[model samples]
Target: MASLELRNVNKRYGQGQADTLKNINLSIDSGEFLILVGPSGCGKSTLMNCIAGLENISGGEILVEDQPISGMSPKDRDIAMVFQSYALYPTMSVRDNIAFGLKMRKVPQARIDEEVERVAKLLQIEHLLHRKPSQLSGGQQQRVAMGRALARRPKIYLFDEPLSNLDAKLRVEMRTEIKLMHQRLKTTTVYVTHDQIEAMTLGDKVAVMKDGIIQQFATPQEIYNSPANLFVASFIGSPPMNFIPLRLQRQGARWVAVLDSGQDRYELPLSVEDGQSLEGREVILGIRPEQITAANEGGPALRAEVQVVEPTGPDTLVFVSLNEVKVCCRLAPDAAPRAGESLALQFDPDRVLLFDANTGERLSKAPEHIPAGQSGNIAQFAAR
Candidate 1:
């Protein structure tokens, strides 16, 4: 296991082109798992290649255990990487493919056999060892790729969407297995994926990347609950955060967001600090669907015309329009009302997020109060 650090890392494909990665900074402790997530072309994969020495950085440094490794070759980095493509030798048997890495490193024949057996069993691919890559299924081939990486005790392991090719059911099974293996091995790892569920469930720390930049690096909960900006807030959540754009007006001393559903207007209280900045200005009110609930229990209520109701097995998603933007409310399955019906929704003021609609930045200056375990020590990168 090893600690990894990236300081002001920057990558550019060419002088006239946009930089693939910009002023990137992150660190992870030994035995910790860090996930990198972003849309395609956002440079998440490029950042991974940089760390593995598959691609060189244009500026800054990458350090492993406080030793500079920016100039190291891929083989000298003491890291193992599993690519989205399995990259198995077509003619090699699964066992040979897994043993190839160890053989090149000149591991003793007995040790290589033992190591191959260890990873095969861990990945549950022991039965398919003698099969050629062409004879194995995609999922099995992925396991062989994982076995090849796990065969060596590298300082770090890098997984770039290794399960993206698997079916949903197999992907979930492999996810659980990966978690179990990580718990047992305690190897420092960096994973990149576009799946929100993977970003939330795996990883000790999650870095939400976009346009080649690390937007937010924190625990899964922080990225979900207290996103630093509108983009981070929308990207990390399923069904996405509800963005209701409206002008803020002062009602008595409190600032209120006027919500209109074509018939009536209801006001929702805004933070005092946020209210101060937007005396008569416009801003977006961001709330998660789960934050909105039935008002029968008593809270600030705003009546909206329900446009649609979608039942997602576990919960019912109610769609409504507020100031021309569609807002979703996650309601209990049994509490769902019919479409075209008006239902009063209760919102928690403290849970409401206010963002500058034009800039897509959080308007409230309040320091994000990340709940404990929210970051999982991702900030420790700065210390290293």
Candidate 2:
């Protein structure tokens, strides 16, 4: 196991050109899993390649266990990478594939055989060891690729969208398998993916990237509940956070947000202590679909016509027009109203978030955290 760190890392293609990576800084503790996630063209893969020594950094250092490795060749860096394509030699049996790396380093054949068996059993692929890559299922082949990397038993393991090519069901399965494998091996790992689900479920720390800049780097829970910027808030959720443009209104001693549905209006109370800075300003109010529910306690309620209803098994999504924008409300499937039906929606004030209108930076402070396994809704959506 090893710790990884990048200090003021910078990458550029040529002189006078925009940097591919800009002042990137991150640290991962030994045996921790770190996921780098963002949309395509977000420099996640570029950053991963840089860490793997496939691309040299323009400035700064890459360290493994506190030792600088910026000038080391990929082979010398003691990192094993599992590529997205599951790069297996077509003619080699799974056993040979798993042992190829050890053989290249001239580990004795007996030792190579022992190492191959260890990872094959570890990956639960012993039954398929004699099969060629062409004979195994996508998930099985992915295991072989993983076994290859695991055989090296390097200081750090790098996975670049290793599950991207699998079917949705298989992808979910592989995700669990990978998580279990990490738990067992306890090796330092760096994973790059565009999938938010993977980022939320797999990482001890997640770095959300955009335009070659890291938007936020924190635990999955922190990123979900207290994203540093609007992009991070918008990127890490499943149903995505709901954004409504609003002008803050002062109701004497308190600040509030005006939410209008054209049918009815709601003055959702704000938790701002610095109301003087926000009063009457056009900032964005971000509420998660789950936080807006069927009115019950009558705290902050609004009446809106249901524009659309979508049933997604576990919960139904109810859509309505609010403040001239479409807003989604997550509801129990049995509780959802039909389209065109009038629905009374309620807001959870403590869970609401505010963002600066122009800068897209978070304006609200992170809310107090409830202990884990207490609050179930991720729709609290960047409240912190």
Each model's TM-score, in the order given?
0.93, 0.94
Clashing pairs in 1: none
lDDT of 2 at 222: 82
> Where is model 2 poorest over a 10-residue stretch in terms of lDDT?
375-384
Q: Rate the local accuracy (lDDT) of all candidates.
A: 0.86, 0.88
Model 2 Cα lDDT, one tens digit per residue, 143-194: 9999999999999999999999999999999999999989988989999999
Predicted model with the maximum lDDT:
2
User: What C-alpha RMSD separates each model from the true structure?
Assistant: 3.3, 4.2
Model 1 lDDT per residue over 112-183, tens place: 999999988888898999999999888898889989998998999999999999999999998988888899
Off by over 4 Å in 1: 274-276, 297-299, 365-384
Give the Å error, residue 273, model 1: 2.7
Clashes of each: 0, 1
